[model samples]
Target chain A: MAVSSTALVDEVVADVVDRVRGTLEDVFAAVAQVAERTTAIAAVRAAGRAPTTADLAALRPLLHERLRRRHDLISGIGFIAEPGLLGDVPAWLEWWQNHGEDGLRPLLPDLDPGTSAYSDYTHWDWFALPRATGERAVAGPYVDYLCSDEYSLTLSVPVQHGGRFLGVAAADVYLRHFEAAVLPLLRRLPAPAALVNARGRVAASTDPRHLAGSLLRSVSGRSCGPIPLTLVTALPAPRP
Target chain B: MSKLSNGALHAVFAPVGNLARVDAVVRRLADAIELGLLADGEQLPGESELATRLGVSTVTLREALMALRQQGLVTTRRGRGGGSFVTAPDQPRTARLGHRLADWSTEELRDLADHWAGVAGTAARLAAHRTEPEDLVPLQRSLEEFEAARDPAARGRVYGRLHVELAAAAQSARLTKEEIRIQAEIGALICLALGEDDARAAVVELHRALLRAVRDGDAELARSLAERRVQDAMERLIGLRLTVAG
Candidate 1:
């Protein structure tokens, strides 16, 4: 029984790793494509020259094509270049949700300060991690108030050419879907199993007793790159 | 009513009990085949012993076997060392299957997808949490079988078998039972439209990814992929229905 139980965990790990890899690769590719295409333009060359509304307007359709390819998994996609380009305010930020009758439609207010949707996103992990590391990064499984107050993970890739950082391209996926997919498997296990993130917070678990965000004892887990989520299993009682 | 004796009344009504006995026997054997629990070409025990095991009379068991034979799910041979044997499951004909499905509205298809998604998704998630490496042997074997099957019927059986394997890995008997029932109900219709090479290839890719997810213990990914697969099958059938109607 124990041997069979371990095999079940192994299968789940294999699937999660593939999905994470695929999703991250797609996000990175979309970022690279946008960076490659946008950089070719002479007008948007410096830190001060972030793409204008007209520039983003022209580029939306292209990014929409990429978004449609993974419509089943993704909720929204966004790009935020260095904030100084338009003025002192955080400008050059554009995000689109998979809404509207046809395809991806632009999210309103564009992070404007006075709007209720305003956020100091410069410090948020999704934007901050890629900027700090200058490599692909993932953030959240947190409440994304800006994107619908749904629990979501944001995968971001830094757009850089010749050591000059232009911005970051990112996508959002609701965690509910992940839970929808994963919780049942956990629930079926005879022993309790907890899915823990890098910070050691339980993301999901078979033990109905273990709530999300609670810290779980580190036992066994499988990591996917930097995410480092572990599947910790509860040990059995001592046999006399 | 008062004039009738109990024994005489039982004699008058025993056929109802016999009918039920035959039905029970038939369902037990048929469900086992549909769920892939009983392998094709497997031999049954001699009639007397089999009937005893099933706690049914020989006549009733024979009636049930005849029903199975008529449905082309079983074959009987007469000679030395001969007994009842299961026939390989056949793929449902498109026209006949489409007619049977005509009563299923788009809403019903969606509901089936929803039901399948819930069962499979949860089974995968649980399997990820509970499965050990050794438990993956059956799942991997199913994957290999699916890849090697060149014929549509073989591919279809393997495809449906994958879910049952996952449910077993989950170590949940209830989920496994539900998976078996769902497969028996819808596996034929799903396989009917997957005869096209391109469509089958796409499904194969999805299964490969799903297997990888399970192997990696990524419960979230495995669950999502399982749900998506059912949803895709339902959508494909709905589209086929639309085209046939038009």
Candidate 2:
């Protein structure tokens, strides 16, 4: 029974890992398609020129359409241009919200990312991770302090044009929403179980002791590829 | 940590508006004890310390403790190794449980059920939204106790404590206090209704489903389950009332 329980937990973890990776991959593909189809983004790539106000206006509808399509799974979606990539345009940030007052809203006043009020996104994890790793990145199930104190995760896929890195196209998912889809399976296990990130922080756990965001001490489980998350049948016994 | 030691319970210790000091102290302490926030046989602070903490006079605290003693909910010792101690609560008889239900008309019972449904639904929703895995430990433990308890009063206390713990997981003191109040009011009735072993089994299964919903962070489903549980309990009580009347 113990062996089967352990195996069952491993299978569940592997499935969750695959699903998360697949979801992010789909987001990456969607962003790539959006960049190719939108005149604003496409024209910049084709003409090898900086984006203009007209380009932003053209991109807004496309971004909103994409966000509306994924509204059920995500709260917000954005395309962040690399700082100074658009010449006089600074970095264009356009995001669509599905939360309160839902609809498309520019992070800046009047489609301008060059304003003094809008801070630089050069250092942000969503931008920095993809830029640095050149891989699709998953940021957090941590609090989105800048947006709201709600638990959230950001998935970003690097957008590139001819080997030159542009910015990242990203989406924000409220962690609770994601958990609603994932937690049922974990709870079905007979033994205590948890999904822990690479840092050993729990994303969700059936074992009440291994709490979300709490670090797991010496947890043993299966961790599959693409995502560094583990599914453990049992956490290490508590310190004496 | 003992529930009394929770900083959140401090809100109940505050003087209730428009209530006499002794009455308020009695209500607060009784409510706490009934809700399992004051565990059985746990030692309470010295009278002077408790009075200071509650912001009430020592005389009022003494009066309140005396009243609790009279009710068999508290015990006091005079010598060393002494302070006021909570009594191991007895299982209230079916007669006592039914007596509270008898006082309420069907309409009053319905209204109370309606109010309870809203409170329970909100508590479940917020608990699912805000609770961490660790936060649900108390709730899970309470459910296990409910399942294992053979005594009807023990089952009822554990049942009520489950909801109170869910409210605490919501991270809102007001909701937690409100849940405790509702639990105290409805506990006896639920106990009477769930006395049959089959009824108790059904409630446990429903509780398990509700726990799954909360664990999964499905706030809507959690709220629905909680509301349905309350509605079902109220219906059971009303059926019992009608049977007795007929």
Candidate 3:
């Protein structure tokens, strides 16, 4: 009976674990799209090709008129919380906040530090959470991208330029949307699956609490405490 | 980052006349519906420009217009100069899930029924297995209510609450939330079917089976029985054969 119960649990777990991978894939795809667009926009402006007033006309395919309009209308748009306070802040911070406020806010509201993410933690270091596999020394997932609020599954990526990390440009995608959007796309077999972050919090799952407080003490071949991850091998490694 | 001609590249904001630019747009559009600041067919600005003027974006403005559209106050025309215009609002779509019903397939109906039976059955089984004896009265009340309600919407609500109460009785919030979302989705699907009352009967029987299995502390039997209830339900949805014909 125990073995049968284990098998049934395995079937359900496999279904949920696939969702985690799906969530991660969708998130990564969205981020990659932003990254590509960012590089292109930067290149177009930096090419030093002076534009006639005609160049500003909405006829160019290279320019997203809506984005250009937004860049014009919305000052300092990128990956920050209070873009309104961008008055004296550095241009980098302004750029970060513009995208962060508009793009990340609706999708991942909990990650807004200015709103609710770090509202409880005053002056606490953002990168203090046990590192998953991404940034090594950055001080934040700055989950507090809002006005220092507590964020849900927020991640910070330090924008690197000329070897000095020019402040982090962050993007926080909601885990719930990740689960909804991409989880349905994952192919599942009879085995159970899981998405264990560096700290072992089960972000979202079919079996919500089955892995709560189930920490990964080491990424070195961790087993889910006797519930051998039968299909963990199929999941993608986190991007380096 | 690219260097730009500082002043030439300045952000151009369409000035807001007041606090409620987007609201003003809608109200103007609505009032114009009768007064002709808009005619029955005149076009308006695209969402982005309007949102920018209103200090909003296309999406936020759309969300507001969507509400008006829901209220049967406006519609959008396509093609050049196409934008939101006043319309005679139709009856708003209810939470009935009935509007999404026309494309509803028997397969979808059966899948929904089976999912509810299985999830709720497991929940019921768990409740019986774990609920304090004192908890039985509410279950009894819920059970009574499930049968007493007759209107499809009202019965659907009772059906959902029955499963919710059962899951809460099982003592796991994780389980209860999952069941709640499942129930909501199922509610939408259930509304599409003509035999929702019959589905209620299926839930009641499974509720009983779950109660018995849980009373026995038979987790294995409980889970499998829950699964069986789902199978029984799946059989009822049109267009599926249980056993393959040779």
Which 10 consecutive positions of candidate 3 chain B have the poorest summed lDDT?
B1-10
Cα lDDT, model 2, residue B8: 26
Best by TM-score: 2
TM-score head-to-head 1 vs 3, winner? 1
Q: Write the per-residue lDDT of candidate 2 for residues B139-244, one digit (tens) a residue.
A: 6767787888876656765676677666656544456666666664556467777878888788888888988898888889999999988888888889888766
lDDT of 3 by residue, A1-240 (tens): 122366765655555455544444443343334434443433454345422222222122222322244332221123321222122321212222224334422112222222111112212232222122235221211122223222234433433223423233333433343344534422243322344443333333333333322222233322333222222323333323
lDDT of 1 by residue, B1-246 (tens): 111111111111223224377765665565445433344786766788667666788888899899888767789889997899877557555554565456457886788789999999998887666554544665676777677777655566667767776775664556765676676556656776676777777777887788778778798999999888778777888888776652
DockQ rank, highest first? 3, 2, 1
Candidates' RMSD to native: 24.8, 22.1, 19.3
TM-score of each: 0.42, 0.44, 0.32
**Per-residue CA lDDT of candidate 3, range B85-178, in tens?**
7563344333213333323456655666666666666665655445434444555666676677665544554555555656655544556655
TM-score for predicted model 1 compared with the true structure: 0.42
Candidate 2: which pairs clash? none
**Regarding DockQ, does 1 or 2 come out ahead?**
2
Higher-ranked by lDDT: 1 or 2? 2
